[model samples]
Target chain A: MNTLKDKATFKQAFIDTLPVMSGYLIMGAGFGMVMNSYGYPPYLSTLMAVCIYAGAMQYVGANLLFTGVSLFSVALTTFIVNARHIFYGLTMLEQYKKAGKEKPYLYFGLTDETYTLLSRPLSVKNKRAYRFYVTILNHSYWIAGCTLGALLGSAFPQVRGADFALTALFVVALVQSLEFHKRNDLPALIGAGATLLSLLIFGKDNFLLPAMGVIVALLLLLPEKEAKA
Target chain B: MTTHTYLAIAMIALVTALLRFLPALLFSRMERTPRFVIRLGQDLPKAALGMLVVYCLKDLDFTSLQGYLPATVACVLAVFSYATKKSSLFSVLLSTIAYMLIMNLFF
Candidate 1:
């Protein structure tokens, strides 16, 4: 493949990702631990880290797999959970179009952290290499963290309540979503209401899909807000 | 892992990658992103993430204090920590510990 030989860009990329490294390692390990606690293999967690790199979705996906949830629900949940990436891709279209050989990977590896880092103007001589290295470094930190957590989980399989990490994760996301998105109140209310209603109606074993349906239906019917300049 | 599980993971990965890739592929040739998609992108996440929070708490038993108290306290802690510190790691870590302690000690 294309060898990115610029050490300067790589160094800059590495430094930029140091914060993400700590977060990814801890979060990825938590994902791995959760999966391992459910009796899945470490390789499975590693595979997820490689294939599906989204942290929130990985935790959700592991729960789905463990529960033997239907494939349709899996796809639907993934789409809803990851829908934000569409906007991220929209914003990056111009930059990635010129990415050449790295276009596909750069697109695939565009997690939230990588996208945030790349959105900033870079001082490196090779912007392309910087972009690629940033993506690669963030990805590697995630994989390493997953592997490390899976091994640790296996060593101490008695660790109860690790699965609560999933709840904490979604909680953090919900908090951040509310914090940043000023107009998020109505939609958030619709979401919680629809989900609680579904759970009560459909019971514990199967409420997610219907809850998602109601949320989507309700949100779509609402008038679109005026576009910002 | 079972083949079914692998299939499910593949589906998740495919959909996620496609979501990230489709905008670039479709919109590169278009003048501007469709208003419908843009609106959905902004509004859907808030709703979906809120749904996820409720989904996570679905199993909490309301009839008994033990079943629901820990989760309630932990969730409140999570929200408070994230709102104040804005550190996802610290919030998640702190709330999870609080959850484990409550679950082990009381319920």
Candidate 2:
């Protein structure tokens, strides 16, 4: 009886995550290609995709690795880039309590897409099994994408400006963020302004760290009015 | 050198997992999330993404068309495509392909 139920849960999980499958495949491939063009091997991309698993951070991390940044810088950048996951975890606190042994992995796999899916009221009977399958399946899609992309990138390493995909990715993220949190232009403006200022004052050679610092400080200092819930 | 790369990857993975784990840990021990942390989480992402976009474009040289044109056009396309279509894959794929085409064909 349990096995039959589990099988049904797995099927539902697969269907639920189909949309993420497509998104992860392409975005993961873009990250893999960027890593390959920067001279990293395909296996390394796979390793990062499996371990780090965060989309934007992996792209930024590839660039940081290419430039040979220090480990402290890597840690700092990872925290700043992925801080949004904090909110994801908070929201999942109750839903994941019943997750039992799967709770840790559930927390680890709480990505933007997965969070969106899970946060929606569940229709499945076995929420725990469904969540686990969704997380694992989405992860597999990302790994597949990263591996395929790396292989393709190695085959055609001469694809110039493949790195620009990272820029385009961030642009998409920025626009999405704006739409998600309507009337967020002020913070966005502050972010851009701080970065440009840091870029000029600190110089291109070493601007990211200061820009990050300034952005955090300004945001903390000037809080926006909380939206009515 | 390879060891360094692996070590950096490990550090990044650790930090990232830690951020994902933070709220879980705190909430498990407490009743609710503090207002400060919630506010930071709510506001930080948009600004961070904005900063990242500028970081990505930091190398654009304004002195020549070849240096900045492809990036500028692709970014504009990315913004408009995402705004109208609301499909991340379509917007990213289109802009990236357009950037590559302009770079390869014209320059």
Candidate 3:
């Protein structure tokens, strides 16, 4: 039956989300450790992860929460900081349209990792089914990691420095992006330059938004040679 | 804990989810999206990522700069290694270990 096939496809999609889940576990655990160190209960941290599901933003939120920052300020910051998700959603419109009933879940599941996985030209029987499966699978992984971290926070008090893992992951992602594009350091240069300029001009707290704004503006305005496969 | 903290967390989560989920849900219903929306999507992710990288490195103090210097070197080394068609894992591992050693020695 069609329903049976859909179930099977969804199961496979979950299976395909394993890689992303692994990454999320490590990062989420790091977040848990940091939150515990800051005297927040692990359950709170886990809840934040489950609900917000934005990694860096959650980390930033934890700090802001500790300081008793206003909700308005946090909301404003998140909008400015994550404004890029708007673009991410835009790019996926065409792909997501063909997703049918699986569309809602696909939209919710589209994290950076999921996006990367979906964007790749991988083998799949049903692209929409696989996409939805991958998205749900990745979300489950993140939620699982967050819950595990919360439970482990108290018993294993001294969580080591795991923040570096995120940086390492990004470094790996940058390398992969480079390899994918066959480019010679342009992306890295732009990233570093924008970051440095933003830091100098905007201070630590506000640098990211303006820097990103500059980079996106520049990339959009400048014309590039068409990519050749 | 104050009620304000709890409320703040809830609000943050709500806003984030709305931004993330609404567009995908609403836009998919339409047969055709406007040109501006399409253009916005194309440019947004990279810009956001650029911002995130800056956000992470924003707290780099001069004193800690020395600690991160080796990481910078490792990044360059990794790029060259990648250029030579080496495995990405190998390049990242090599640089990470190098960074750790340098950090331990200096800091």
Best by TM-score: 3
Give all candidates' CA lDDT scores: 0.78, 0.77, 0.63
Worst 10 residues of 2 chain A by lDDT: A177-186
Query: What DockQ number belongs to candidate 1?
Result: 0.45
Model 2 stretches astray by more than 4 angstroms: A1-45, A54-103, A106-142, A145-153, A156-166, A179-183, A204-206, A223-229, B1-12, B23-28, B82-90
User: In candidate 3, how many Å is residue A25 off?
Assistant: 3.3
Using DockQ as the measure, the top candidate is 2
Error of 3 at A195 (Å): 4.1
Model 1 chain B poorest 10 in a row by lDDT: B36-45
DockQ of 3: 0.36
Clashing pairs in 3: A87-B41
Q: Model 1 Cα displacement at A120 (Å)?
A: 15
After superposition, candidate 3 runs with Cα above 4 Å error: A1-23, A37-41, A64-69, A116-126, A154-162, A179-195, A224-229, B1-3, B22-30, B36-62, B85-107
lDDT of 2 by residue, A1-229 (tens): 2122498889888876665675677778888899989988899999998998988799999988888889999998887777757656766776777677778888998776676556545778878888888888888988898888898974533567765655676677677666444445667777788889988998875676677677767777875666642
DockQ metric for all predictions: 0.45, 0.46, 0.36
| Structural RMSD, model 2 | 6.3
Model 2 pairs whose backbones collide: none
State every prediction's TM-score relative to the real structure.
0.61, 0.62, 0.73
Scored against the true structure, residue A98 in model 1 reaches a CA lDDT of: 64
